[model samples]
Target chain A: MSYIAWIISIGNELLIGKTVNTNAAWLARKLTLLGYDVRRIITVPDNEEDEVEVFRDAIKRGVRVVISTGGLGPTFDDKTSEYLAKALNRKYVINDEALKLVIETFKLKGLELTEPRLKQAKMPEGAKPLPNPVGTAPGIWVEEDNTIIIALPGVPAEMMGIFENYVEPKLREIGPKLHFIERSITVKGVPEADLAPIIEKGMKMSNRVYIKSHPKGHEIRSPLVEIHVYVSSEDVRKAEDEINKVLDFLIFAVKEKGGEVLST
Target chain B: MSYIAWIISIGNELLIGKTVNTNAAWLARKLTLLGYDVRRIITVPDNEEDEVEVFRDAIKRGVRVVISTGGLGPTFDDKTSEYLAKALNRKYVINDEALKLVIETFKLKGLELTEPRLKQAKMPEGAKPLPNPVGTAPGIWVEEDNTIIIALPGVPAEMMGIFENYVEPKLREIGPKLHFIERSITVKGVPEADLAPIIEKGMKMSNRVYIKSHPKGHEIRSPLVEIHVYVSSEDVRKAEDEINKVLDFLIFAVKEKGGEVLST
Candidate 1:
């Protein structure tokens, strides 16, 4: 069975549309490739109440994994650590390892540790800090009865750094064994409305495979559509076979309907 | 008071990272510009149960406006309309106007209306169908007791066509009078940790103005950061004045700390 996951992206910049939320998309891609069924991608503001509420809600929903990005900074609005502790009913304390990492990072710059810099070391009691190789604020990892929550910095580079180095390996060990396979084929001269029945028949043929169409041309005139066929299953060979069978059937059906298969 | 808004982006392709949710970002930007305080952006798969659950939850949360994109198509998995009717406890029916639009679209394509294509006209009992300028599926608009829900097609061109032509004008008429102003300035040579106190002070001086710092450079070395200052108020002049005041103070503070003002 695929493990359920939710991605919480925290920042006022995202809610206000100042940022495009590429972090959520990137995480979703990684999680999906790791065989985790990402159920939700929630973007909330930097407010403590909102952050804590989402964290609690994720736990209540019993998702196996929860990954959040943003609010792991030294600014007054960066409250992910504090609010996560409140949500988990844990004491907010200074973690020794996180503090040492922060001190070492600042020491490299030939500077003394200030209060704002030290704030990066604070996390929920019993939570572990994943060392950040490129930034001061380390990624946070918290394990609960039913959920594992990981909070990373909003910075693209820092978030990617910790996720690739620390989180990916651990998740790979525990993630589901499902293998996913997908293929896309572009068709011309066939409107999506006309191709809908063919897609429906294709889906009915294989209950395991999902077929979706994206129209690239005008509906009333020249119709160009890209059909995506994908499936995930415990058996890699079965998954591949299912995808190939459905793909061949779709190509044959499209050509039978006078549609030109442009590319696969 | 700023009206609260939420954007629900629907599609499995987005969840699996096959597509980036640019539709949500575009809608959020438009809503924010129209003086709507966008609170959340939720992305869910193309499942009827999940769609209905999120729609009901948005109503329970009492957001003033909820806009959803995707799943309005001529395929089997396109269930946004059906699930929305269920969520609102309204009988799903095909309206004459919507039927006419769908028939005309098919006629333009020199084709007869099939069952799957006809399914696009079905909507809640009291809903209105926004005319689609570029696509076959008409956008669905439903007004609840305290919430307004608008469902548009998942296709980027079609969704944008309906929203820009039909929905934006009506929203402008009923939206809040607040005007939002934002300004960003880049600074170098001052770490974000050191700039945190100044940002906190700037925020304290003006409760209405929000100031956020985005670190562009590494913390230990050449520290480069961009500071965003923004505010929204009923009075356009007051909003502009407040933003300028906060921006000036932040710039002065950054320069006072020996940070080079790269650009504004």
Candidate 2:
């Protein structure tokens, strides 16, 4: 079975360019490192209809895991939790554990608890509250069948804190057992076309080998081209060995073409 | 009608976490600043199937403009141009203008032209080749109805170079008459809940006003809360004036709560 994940970033700030949606990129990188195939990422303004549509579409597309960031705060525009509840057709209530955390956080900060602040405690029925030691708003983990949806705060620091402290470990526990590895060798001074035959030969030698080139600087001026080699396999150690062998051959090929490896 | 755009980052490096997809963020910022709603961002490995699936999905979801980055290289993995052609049901052919540019680039680089390098000149039939003065791979611009799909190189410098020189001007010309402007004010000392009432009043004062809270550094024992106020309007001056009014009210409310505005 193929495992896929979808990321949703919820914020009007991101949509309007007031804030960069770093959460999606960060999560995508983490998921990739953990061997989850991130199929797509969606960013929507704080709108119930748009968020619901994205959520429903992702579910229908057979995404095994759905990670949502942002709009979990204690304001009117922060409507992700409630909207998610509505979309999932689940009842929402003030979770005691979550409320306790919120109240304790307020007391620790020497702040008065307000009604909207209390709303942070409310969550969709059956959803597990992920501890948020970094913020008053707790991350939520909702599971239906085998598909999992984790809702995290939009703040980069808070999101990272929650993911590192709880989400990452939990995901690893439930994630697949497949092992994947990638390697890159930067090449300079060689035109990409002349390098293709060599890359083709390298790929033929290693089943997992792939090459990509990126041209740097202005096209009119002198451009620097860097070629990256990627290798992935079920056995990480074997993948590394295969990649090293290919890299050695590629370096020789570059020199033959009057170019040199930028660096290994 | 609200304008919506989608960004597709096509590369294997992005999938393996070897490279950060900065192009998506940069393009998102640009599109947002231009008053275009970026609905989603999809990053797929340099696989034809995944590329076609993502492209079809984005188009089905009604994205007016789909900007694809990467996979315009002169290698076997550089199949974005071909896959995109299949997705759009168009024939792939080498355009004379693009061929000339590719040959000129190789001539200037003092590199012998090879078959794979010549493939960089091929584009979907009837597609307009966007100038790529910085690299051998030229960008392709294809339009069907009101939806526009632009394919550009993946390299950050080349992507930005082509965007600034070719894409941006064309986008502005075909884009909506809407204008976008935003301002953020950071607030500290008040919990988001206690600040909700003030935020509600601020929102009522202006239809475009929206407030979001981001919790920062919660794990360090003392957490800081940053609230951002965003306003979007078709008229720049009106938007700025309205945001200022909301800022004034927010400042008054924060001061009433014995809190302070960190920045305006």
Candidate 3:
């Protein structure tokens, strides 16, 4: 991928460990599959000042796309949309389409539409509405400097439902065509230190391959370390070839080090 | 807590969804108990440029403490210590104590001490070594500009071992004395919009209480929304009293709104 993507998970629950930031992980996987090199996942608390600073900095850092989840509810604390509006220097307005979505969602739930409920419809000016089928709040999609910023609800079901149904189609249409392939090998008795030089050699041999090692000492997985090699390209065959070459080299290196290569 | 802390979870596995960042959640909870306002969790790939830029920016932002997990292994990709050294403009040097610990760990494991393994002992100049009892790599703890930067192993067992044994005690010794209390009430049939006004009133009525609402629409959880009221103070009694006040108000308001209050 030519550009880097980012994920911002906004909520106090995340900071407090009351809620795990699974939204960031899930989005990262989807974006990577779609060929965006996801650079960072920033989990900020539900505060306007912090959100605004982080969001603005992300854009300033030349992030091509940023998918933010949380703080879309109709409470005083849920200010992610508002903070994003300020960050983008856009007015917080009641988008007609988003208002329609909120009204429709409440009707479907047979719930009352109070004045505060209308706050759910407020989004940054010029943002496209991403409708949520599973919840009341509608997501916002804004584009500035050719950078796509998507703001989605915090609730897991609602966030996933909107991202898959509405956001995924938009991304597929605009995102560059790319495919990624990955292969991993687990090596027991070999530390990453011993495996580093061989992995470095593999990196020099391959053009697009990215190799990483995750060490797990003595807990459950018998392997002391796992080496993952990934490659992305427009052609599926090219990606597969690049990843496989690195994986093969690492496996052989593990064998030479007197380590058991667990995964084929 | 008076100071803001952050977590930087490194490694490409986290970004690719091959690994879920349970370490960040675990650290956040631990720091919260240590009386720190855990602010952000940044998950970055194992690239030096990315790591240096992020680590520098975080320090520039004046985070009181930064706890980073992953990338403390003995691999070419493990560059957290090197990046932190560059970020702080300090020389990366091999700490004698850390080298001793690494050599001892290898001896205990009956593993060969390769030259590549020696890289694990290198740390930012003037940083203290937090020994890892469960793994080879010793954690690096550096204090710069009054900001405490801690670099721990990516491996779950090693990371937890260092944090609990060494980092935890240090934080406890230096961190301010404070205690927090949280009381949450689940309300069915009331959307966040309807609860917002009451929550705003509760906020005004208390000095230390912080109220937040989590919406879960038609999920396995029975309640549609859970409003959490939290308070922190040096005095445990003050925190308890403040949380109880908000909890009482929320319960009454939910009842008035014709919503079932699930918690006592």
Report the CAPRI category for model 1.
medium
Cα error, residue B264 of model 2, in Å, equals 2.2
Model 3 clash tally, residue pairs:
1
lDDT (tens digit, per residue) of candidate 3 on B50-91: 899878877887888899998887677788998989999999
Q: Residues A32-104, candidate 1: write the lDDT tens digits.
A: 8888999999999888788889999989878999999999998999989999999999999999999989888
> Candidates' lDDT values, in order?
0.91, 0.77, 0.83
Identify the leading candidate in terms of lDDT: 1
lDDT of 1 by residue, B2-121 (tens): 389999999998888888888888888889888899999999999987899999998987889999999899888888999999999999999788999999887876788889889999
- In model 1, the clashing pairs are none
Docking class of 2: medium
How displaced is residue B192 in candidate 1, in Å?
A: 1.3
Name the DockQ score for candidate 3.
Answer: 0.60
Query: What TM-score would you give candidate 1 relative to the actual structure?
Result: 0.98
**For model 2, how does the per-residue alpha-carbon lDDT over B226-262 read when each residue is reduced to its tens digit?**
7676655667788788888888888888889877777
Q: Where does model 3 exceed 4 Å of error? A: A217-223, B217-223
lDDT of 3 by residue, A67-136 (tens): 9998887777788888889999999999999888878877776777777788888888998889887767
Q: Candidate 3 has which clashing residue pairs, if any? A: B70-B154
